[model samples]
Target: MKRVLALPYLLWMVVFVILPVFLMIYYSFNDMSGNLTLQNYAEFLSSNYIKMTLNSFWYAFLITVITLIVSYPLALVISRLKHKTFWLLIIIIPTWINILLKTYAFIGILGINGILNSVLEKFGLMKIQLLFSDFAFITVAVYIFIPFMVLPIFNSINGINKNLIWASYDLGASKWEALTKVIIPLSLEGVKSGIQITFIPALSLFMLSRLVAGNKVVTLGTAIEQQFLTNENWGMGSTVGVFLILFMVFVMLVTRTKKESI
Candidate 1:
């Protein structure tokens, strides 16, 4: 009976997720120049591809680390609140806005002639270049993706049996020890899920980086988009897309293996 209602969701997922992914894989293996060729993969193996992939990973890693640093404390603060729904709404409200709109709003706040730089100049401090750099890219990425890190960790930590925490305190164990040994260990799934979310969206952070930070700092996403739009090199673009997909799968597999080992 439950399957009757679940069938639509299953069908929806099959149509949207499964089909598109299969099609993308098919597209990746296809090469133009009048026939399908292995040239796409070989071209992607060039130095530029290697460098772009590394750069993308480096930026994504920084964004993930920064998001973790910011979100964990916010999640903790949130956990103590009286109205869980209210606090959740407060955290999630901004996410409802358009991503492009949020990026532009950050630009208005951080750009050289924007509010922050203007305020700094008024105070007679150094007029630093705030926008169109790695810092800007990362800061925006962190702001955008922090919620991904938060929700999973929040759910993870929240699901922990409160009695255990109380029990540890009653047993004369310090709160720090209790959290480190008991809470965090049990919450590992949440942390790992948060990391997966962090890495995945951040891995595809082309639009925000290109929009908020200008076209200066490039990632594999930008490289792929360029191949599709600017260069109109669909074969090469699809090859880069293939590489990005493979990287995501590899990361997910590694994460799954690590979790299973534990």
Candidate 2:
């Protein structure tokens, strides 16, 4: 008992996690009328709530797909590099910058008469609408979250035993089949961890999407922000916050079950 190693983290988790959650639970049960009401949950499960849920899920899914498409091979290449320190710096340096700065940079580059449009106009193409649209939101969110996906996959690939690949080759397995069967399975945990990291953040993308896409793209994060900041609806805001937590929990449970079965 004296050597229990998780005690500090456990204490931190209880203080940080349990306390805030308890507060949210308390607030979620109350209504604007100051009476206990299930209306919050009821409203959350309504058609509009369902659409928000689907929209949030699909939006996150799209970001996840884009991140995977872009990051996997980059991670592979970086994982094999001799100058890993330099490349790792390249990967991690962006995270140190203010997220708002990165988000706003997109506005400067994509707004009307911005970089892309300027290049197009120089090439004799007509002006185009890039800002305040779905593309703006998706692009920024993906740019912001790409590192989250890459680092995890890179770390996972780094952990793979080199001898495993050699052994597969010795067994006459082709490169494609070896990668498909051997490398990918071992890295599923890291990929899953990465997806969880990226999914939660991507689903909750607000400032970037708001700044870049304007109001055209409304996400659960932006909705909660609106509820709290713009609408002054504390009860409803807490309800949405609670719903978001439960949604993450549901995803965790599903992923845990699937992983255990695998």
Clashes of 1: 0
| Candidate with best TM-score | 2
Best by lDDT: 2
Please list the C-alpha lDDT of all candidates, in the order they appear.
Answer: 0.81, 0.82
In model 1, the clashing pairs are none
Question: What are the per-residue Cα lDDT tens digits for candidate 1 across 1-262?
Answer: 9999999999999999888777766666677553567777887888878877788888888888889889887877787788976887787888898989999998898877899998998999988888888888899888888777889888888888899999999999897898788887877787778888889778778898788778777788788788778976777787787777788888777667354767
Q: How do all models score by TM-score?
A: 0.90, 0.91
Pairs of residues at least 3 apart in sequence or in different chains that clash in candidate 2:
none
- For 1-262, candidate 2 gives per-residue lDDT tens digits of 8648889988999999999898888877778776888888888888987788788889888988888888887887898899976897898889999999987788889979799999999999998999998888888887877788888888888899999989999999998988898888877776777788888777778786678878776778887888779977667778888888887887776556354777
How many clashing residue pairs appear in each of the predictions shown? Answer: 0, 0
